[model samples]
Target chain A: MTGVLTVVGLGPGDARWLTPAASEALASATDLVGYGPYVDRVPGTPGQGRHSSDNRVEVDRARFALDLAARGARVAVVSGGDPGVFAMAAAVFEAVENGDPAWRNLDIRVEPGITAMLAAAARVGAPLGGDFCVMSLSDNLKPWEVVEARLRAAVAADFVVALYNPISSARPWQLGAAFKIVSEIRAPDTPVILARAVGRPDERIRTEPLSQVEAASADMSTIVIIGASTTRLIGRAEGEAPYVYTPRFYGVRP
Target chain B: MTGVLTVVGLGPGDARWLTPAASEALASATDLVGYGPYVDRVPGTPGQGRHSSDNRVEVDRARFALDLAARGARVAVVSGGDPGVFAMAAAVFEAVENGDPAWRNLDIRVEPGITAMLAAAARVGAPLGGDFCVMSLSDNLKPWEVVEARLRAAVAADFVVALYNPISSARPWQLGAAFKIVSEIRAPDTPVILARAVGRPDERIRTEPLSQVEAASADMSTIVIIGASTTRLIGRAEGEAPYVYTPRFYGVRP
Candidate 1:
């Protein structure tokens, strides 16, 4: 009665963004595990056991799901964005790899989903047209020294940034600190984009001077920060959406 | 015989990433116009019209498509990834917006597609999980001074970077110069990611120190640069692929 485990990405927010493959994986699962909010995203039906909890307990939840699978329950561990991108996929894998070897034989499949970075990039046009990097601001697991070092390195490298988990109640100052590091290397006018709850209702995305990011309502659910080389504040008239973009090899324009 | 112009995104190189909506848009179009390489990506068909050309002539080619649409050919202005992201979608709109008034009313639909950034991120296992930035090193359309200023600004801000068009035959040194800017403000040992031909059969993605980038076989087709803020180089043992990720939030388990 050994059950298999499949980790799925629900995509940014819209159910339309859900891939058929992901749906099929979840449908075949006897139980689903994820953040309580993310659990609501699964298509509800009878006969599917759901395990939902607060966000802070990802590792514990992942372990719980693995336990179910170890007990032979077909399980699906889901995440809002791509399962691998700052989601539950990696945790599930880590738990399995480090846990008892008995669970290693369980069939594990990872289905990729659209991440917030790409979705937000699309929503705001093409600021991410080229080589860009995404980074989180929270420093609970990693040392702040490490975060600052990377920020300095990234800023010095002139990469456009997509910031995730930019600000939370306990860690509000960290984002501002990161902003200062980038500001030292970038101009005051560099565009800092704030994409809130991308692809979800109540989503808000706006671009402002890099110096003003601290003033924005950056929160646990918010993705914030600046664009690097090649990013520009596109005029609103370019399309229905006002966005930022790093022009890619434009001189070759025919 | 007014023809409609539809812009579609072919998700990150994998066929699985293609959104159903994007697939439907491509199927509905009578003809496809795009860069030669991108045009080849359209799924196989016996009679679909594919107008392909070199990458150098994208603007001319896109404009030509608009003219064809005006002449009543239902043309699909296809670009690899998303059209709006440094691709030809906006160029198409710009051409039409400034073109003859008779061409203004044609139905133009812009469908979101998978961009390279997402494909690269997925391959690397969430290098862009949090706050990040993207930039290009090409100095053809904009002056190097402008590019430098933007780079400096981004550096000051500590954003993770995605570099598009990092090097080419005409501008091989541009990326190096950008690296110099990054080095000015960052540590020499900071992690830099090089993702080549992402999503293609020849895909190569690796993370190394900032100084090693010049020695790498980065070319016009390469996407290069560093992560900022919280990004760190995970051990190669994480998987066959290397990853750089910023910690998620202030208090999440690794």
Candidate 2:
């Protein structure tokens, strides 16, 4: 009996952003596995077994799901945002490449979901409307040198930069370091967006100039967007949030 | 009788990829406006009106939507993929910033959707799992020199690159030009993915080595992805497609 392992993305936060495919995948899953919070988001399906673990042990969780699938259990590995973007899809493939050889033959599929940057970008207007770069500031997997080099190149290339995993208690200064690099290469008044828990009830979205951006406000839930040379902020009425966007016309304004 | 203009993304193509928020917006919209094909994808609602036009007339379509909203009509400007990513969201915002001052005060919201690159990446096993850049190769709006410089910088930084609008009838030579630049900075054996019309019935996904990629295989519906230095392709059984992923460890095997 060939079992199936479908990795699912739960979108950023809201059920409204969830795709029908992901919702259906979750509904039909006999076994669900993922980080505690992501798995908790899915409503209980009677008789469906749930296996939740810490996000740090991605490979172990992946292996456990693969093991279940290999034993004829249809499993779904849930992830926040699109599984392919700094999420569970890569981890599952890594497990397959290095784990039991027979595991490679199992049916595996990844269902895409709305990523944080897109959801966050929507709330603040179209800040990622043009060419852009997405990078994780977390240095747990790679050296900080790699992040610095990539940031410099993206800025030079004039791609709007979206930074994931911006800061955590362990590496609080990383966001500031990124801002310092951006300050050097781009204009001080360029638009900056900090969107925290965008789709959830406690969602907060703010727009500030690159020079005065409040880096300390960002948490694990925050996604930071640094505008390119052409990124702009359109002012609205008093007490109203500004609309942030990067025009498709490249260096020119509307 | 203040009206609302909601910019909604319809994902790549399939209804399964469509989000509930987009569906609700489409259903409630008094007027729908977009490129002819994208607008046609939305199921017609009784008493609802649609304004479809050529893809080239983005700003004009945006203005029409704004005009409808300003006249107390609930309007939805439909777009393929996340409206923020090289789609209609920026165009609408551009229209607002330049059109009428009163347009800025009208209630405008952008609902996000799964962009093409993410959908394409998911089907190919997470080629965009790590640091990445999204760029459009069309030189219609921006100069070719800008595209050339950005491509060079993106490759030098070892960021996985997802190129949109890779080729169109008017810009037949651009994709080849980009390939030449990429070949100079990266290994020829780098993985390349050609995902055309993902999620749609006619979707076709093909992977190749950078040196052997068929530039002519792409059309306007296609999205081209070039792997980074650490990206790998895991071979499967005969006739089975391989899984391509960039590990989170960055330049290191898991």
Candidate 3:
């Protein structure tokens, strides 16, 4: 009996941010596999077996899910944020490419979710309103040089950059390093956004100019949005957070 | 009485992709305002009034919403995808910046949705599995030169590029011109995907080598994804669509 492997995203932290397609996929799965926290986000479905693993074991978790599907056990692999963006979707595909060839034919589907960048951007206003790039700042899988190069290229090209996995225990200085790099290319007045745990009870989104933003305030739950030269901050009444957005039009003045 | 202005995204043409957050925002709104087609996506609430305007008049539409909200109407300004990304969120902010200053004090909120690129990327495997950039090919507001420069910079940076608004009736040549620039920088074997009306009834996602992809097949509703250098295609059972993904590991091999 050929089974199915469905990859779904839980969307930032809230169940309310979950899409109907993702919710349906979760409801239909016989087994759920994901990182412990992400898997726990899904309410228990009767008769559904859940296998939770550590965050570092993405490929292993994906292969395990694939194996379960190969044995005719329907499996759903869950990820926080969009499964396809720095999440389970890529790992699942990586497993399919390298694992047992028969796993290819097992029906696999990926349902997109509201990624952290989009949710974070929404909460803070539209910093990603125009041309933008999303980059993972973690150098765990890739070389540090590669991350810096991509960051420089993205900032130099004037793409509003949304950085994920900015800071962790193992790599603590990357966020500061990213800020320093961006600050050099951008003016001191360029806006920097720190949106942490957006869509969750602990959500905090603040915008500051490049000269004033503190990299230390960011943690793993943070999404760092560095605006383009054209990004603007709209004023608000006293004691209210300002709205930030990058205008749609690109004015190339001589 | 101060009223609320909620900017929400309906996702990419499907009710299933809409987030509960966006849905709740719509449900609580007393008035809905947006581009005509986007405004129509929200199922009519018994007493909620809708103000549909042409797509070209984004600022005008935003000002209208703000005006309604100023008069104590809970207004939701809807967009097709995530409102924060190239949608009503920016337009609303733009209007707030230029219109009556009182609009700034209004309680404005943005609810995220599944954008076209993410939805399209998921339908295929994770083509945007790693660092990626999104750019609109429309030159209506921005000059054609700015578009070309951005296209070149994005391609040269090896960011998997997602092209939105690829071809409109008025801007037929931009998509083709974009392909020519991307081909010059990327390998001929690089994968090109055309995802049209991704979640809607007319959904079609096809992948082709950069060398052979026809520019004319794409229309305004299409999102064109060009693979990064690291993007790989997994072998699939004959007659099955291949899974495309950019691996998490960036082997910037020396």
Candidate 4:
């Protein structure tokens, strides 16, 4: 039996957002592997094996998946959003680059899905309508200085910024620190969108000015979008959430 | 009769990549409006009005969709990729913000899809697995100087940059000029990915060193990805595409 390894994204919380290509890959998979939450998202198959591991052990999990595929097991490595964006695709490639030479010859492919930022941006209006930058706020793999530098540069370039992994139980102060940095370069009234559990039943999207937003609002499930100076909010009649969007035109306000 | 407007993405080329949410919106739409090629992508439905227009008339198309929706038509304005990224979601919101006040009261939603960058990145390996910036190189909406500045800043920040609308028939010199700017800052052996007509039957993906990529290689359908300094390529046995990926670790090689 020739083994094939496919990494697929499940999109945000909604099953409707899952692509047909990903669904097909899951249905044909002989083995499913991912973090416990993501693996649990897949419906159990009759003979398919499920390997769920802790979130922090990406490298170990990747090696295990690669090993299974090497032994002629058809494997599907899953992530919550698009595998290319801070997900299992990179980890799998890292394992292939460093693991046994035979791993490179295994049939590996990445199936893209609707990433969290795109889903969150859709739930709110299109705040990422123009040029944008995506960065992870967690200082686990990189230093805080790098994050701060990217934030400052993105602000200077007037790019709408999406900050992933904004806060966690282990590190709570990073979001506050990031806000302080953005508040320095951007206008106080710049729109900030905090989207939590996007596409889920309990999804919540809130938009406020930079000065008014509290750092405590974000958790691990949250994605923080800081709008550019060109981003604007259109008010509704009464008791309604306003539409927030960045204009396609630059350097001029409608 | 109350009207509703929903903007949805068709994903990149392949129908299988389309999300169920987007498909549902398309099926429920009484009026479908978009650029000609995208409008032609949808299967014809009875009693549904399909309005196809020229490519450059985004604002006009958006207004027409809003007008139809205001008259109690269930409208869906489709774009090639995720509506939030350089697509119709922003254009529709721009129309709402500047057009009739009653349009604000209409139920408008954005259904996200798999954007082109993620699709192109998946066709290769996870080149955008690290921090990244997405920008359009077309100078129609913004100036050429702004594009140059953002490219320089992104390179300086060591970000994997995804360039959309890199080259079009109308303007041919932008890609060459942009490549010159990047070449000045990046290493000679840095990888650049030119993905043209991705997910289509005639799709082509080419990875070459920055020094070897030509300006004429890209067209309107192309998405150019310039990998970060940390990105590396893993070799395959023989006569196979090399796997390109950026390690999760930063400032150190895995």
Candidate 5:
């Protein structure tokens, strides 16, 4: 039996945000593999073996999934948010490209899901309504200079910036550096969103101006969004959360 | 009776890709409003009234949805893909911001879904497997010069660029101009993906080198992806579709 390997996104932390396609892939898999937290999110199924590993072991986990599929076990490699965005889909492809040549013949597919940025955007009323750039703040994969340069370019182009992996225990100062770079170029009144554990019960979304935003507010579970020049706030009645959005209209200059 | 206005995403063209949160919003809606094509995508309910409109009337459609909800109708404003990204969520928020203050008091929520780029990226391997930028080529909202400058900035930053609204019937040359701007800075071998009608029955995905990519190949339904400098093609055995991906590991030159 030629078993299939599927990479599926679980979507932020909400079960309701999970796509039916990804749900079906997980339900039908004989084995599931992913980071421990993501694997824990999947509903338990009878006869399905779960292989959960620690964070930062994406390639190893992907290789394990590929090996399971090669040995005739239907496997699903899962990730939080869309698998294709800084997640398991790329790692699976990398394993296939560099690992055993026979892994190429195995059926592999990526099932998309609602990414964290989209989920955060929805919760906060479309801060990413215009052109945007998504970048990882962690310099583990790339140089810090690349991150700084990309942030500068995004700001110069006036794109709303969605930052993932903004701050971690090991890389606590990167978010501050990023903020310093962006705050220098953007207006003081430009909106910045710090969304933590989006879609989860403990989800916290804070929207502040570029001048007042504190980089120390972000953590590993947080995703930060820096609004473009066009981003604005809709005033709320007393005690209500204000609606934040970047208008679709541009160039006319409000 | 206070009613709710929920803006939901239909997720590319596949019903299976729709999130449960969005599906629930649709099922509970007494009225639906969107562009004709997207409104048609929602499953018709016996009691649900569908209000379809022409394109480019986003604000008008949003107003209609808000009005329906204000008068005690549970209205769902739908968009293709995640409403937060270049879609209906911003329009809805704009209406609420500029419209009656009473509209602010009504219950409003955004239900996120799988955006087109994620769906297209999943279908074509992980072309956006790293840091990327998303921009729309339509000059309807922003200036052509802004688009050109943004494209140049994205190329300079070496971002995998995803171009939405690549070509419309009225704006056929924008994609070509975008292509010209990027090709001038990037390597000739960089990959360019034209994903048309992604997740639909008539979907077509073509991967070509930046040098050979024709801007005329794209249409309103297409989302074009330009790979970063680090993107690579995985060699496939005969008769197999090529796998394109950007590795998770960066800074180490290929």
Candidate 6:
């Protein structure tokens, strides 16, 4: 039996945001695997074997998806936003390398989906249009040294930075530290945008200076941090949320 | 009459890609204004006023939208991708600044949409997940000196870069010039991605080295350029497409 694995991206929460291509791939799968919340967000028949777990079990989940594929099941590994942006696609590929040789023959492909960074960019204006980078401030998986080095590089490069997993319950001050590191390299006047709970109800987006982003309001579920390059502020009134965007250096201010 | 203007984003050409929020905004408009091709993409509506023109006529369209709003008509100024990304939203505001003071009282808002860059990023892998920057190679509006300076800065800063509008029919070699500038500051081994006509039926995505990319086929409709920092060739296969990515620095490659 031929087994195949497809990774699908479920866009920022709303069922309406789900692309038809993504939905069809999920509906055709014989088995589904993913982190718990993401798996739950998938709407469809539950008869397919479902494997879900907390975020901590990535390796285990990867193993499950590969194991199912090895056993001739068409598996769908789902992720919120796009699967490749700090998501599960890499884990599955890594598992293929570490698993039994029999799994090597199985086909695997990654399908694209709308990512939160893209969603957040849309929610605000084109902050990511020109030069921008996406980084996660969460220290749970990597050391601060690595994150700090990247942030410093991002600042010097004048690349707009989109921060992910900014502040969680246990990592309250991680975002502050990242900001400080960025502030050291970039000007205090650099615009910082905080997008809270993107794609979900109660979504909040605001842009301020790198020096003034108070962490008291940021939580783990939020994505935050600064914009660089051509980003600028325009005078927009209340009820008309202002979105900050960097014009393409081409002199086009789209 | 309370004239209102809502700037809507039409994500990358496909009708299915249109967000519900953007669709609803367009549906409610009494006057629709945008570049001719973008205006034509929407379904025809009876009794709705339409304003369309060539690229050079954007400022004219902005004036039209503002004028309609001043007359108390609900207007939706549509832009391809996000209006804020080198689009018409800023032009509208700039027009308001230069126009009669009476129009200042009308409400104006910018509704976000998916950008071409994000869509292109998703088509590939995580080449943009880390610190990245975006730049346009168009010199018609800006001098080559400024573009070269930013390229040097981005290279020194170790940024993954996304290049937009790298070539046009009249300016066929602008991308080659950008490649030469960045190559001076970056290693020849650095990866470069060319995403052409993204999200459209003829979309083409290819990854190569900065040294070899000038020979790569491209057009004015293309987006091109290099990836720096942690960008690496994930895998290369004969007769198969190459894959490039910026490792999720937050964790060990699982």
Tens digits of lDDT, candidate 6, A1-254 = 48988877786776666666677779989988998888888875768878788886776787888888888999999888777667766566556555775655566666665667666666655566554566667666667776677677667656677788887778877777887787787777778777777878888878778778787667766777477755665545556655466654435543
Cα distance off (Å), candidate 4, residue B37: 1.0
Compute the lDDT of residue A166 as modeled in candidate 1.
Answer: 77
Screening candidate 2 with a backbone cut-off below 3 angstroms (N, C-alpha, C), the clashing residue pairs are none
Ranking by DockQ: 2, 4, 5, 3, 6, 1
Per-residue lDDT over B225-244 for candidate 1, one digit per residue giving the tens place of the 0 to 100 score:
57665556544332434344
Query: Per-model C-alpha lDDT, please?
Result: 0.69, 0.92, 0.90, 0.92, 0.91, 0.71
Off by over 4 Å in 6: A96-109, A121-130, A139-143, A182-190, A236-254, B88-111, B140-142, B185-189, B229-238, B250-254
Off by over 4 Å in 4: none
Could you give the interface RMSD of candidate 3 in angstroms? 2.4
Q: Summing lDDT over every window of 10 consecutive residues in candidate 2 chain A, give the lowest-scoring window.
A: A245-254
lDDT for B78 in candidate 3 is: 90
What is each candidate's fraction of native interface contacts (fnat)? 0.27, 0.87, 0.85, 0.88, 0.86, 0.24
Candidates ranked, most accurate by lDDT first: 2, 4, 5, 3, 6, 1
Candidate 4, A1-254: lDDT as tens digits: 27899999999999999999999999899999999999998986899999999997888898999999999999999998999998899999998998999999999999999999999999888999999999989889888888888888988998999998999999999999999999998999999999999988889889989999998998999999999989999999799899999988787443
Question: What DockQ would candidate 1 receive versus the native complex?
Answer: 0.23
Q: What is the lDDT, from 0 to 100, of the residue A217 in candidate 6? A: 68
lDDT, residue A150, model 3: 82
State the lDDT of candidate 5 residue by residue for A179-229, as single tens digits. 899988999998999999998999999999989999888889999999999
Range of the 10 consecutive residues with the lowest summed lDDT in candidate 3 chain B: B245-254
Model 3 lDDT, residue A59, Cα = 94
Between candidates 5 and 6, name the one with more favorable lDDT. 5
Question: Per-residue lDDT for A61 in model 6?
Answer: 88
Task: List chain A TM-scores, every candidate, in order.
Answer: 0.93, 0.98, 0.97, 0.98, 0.98, 0.92
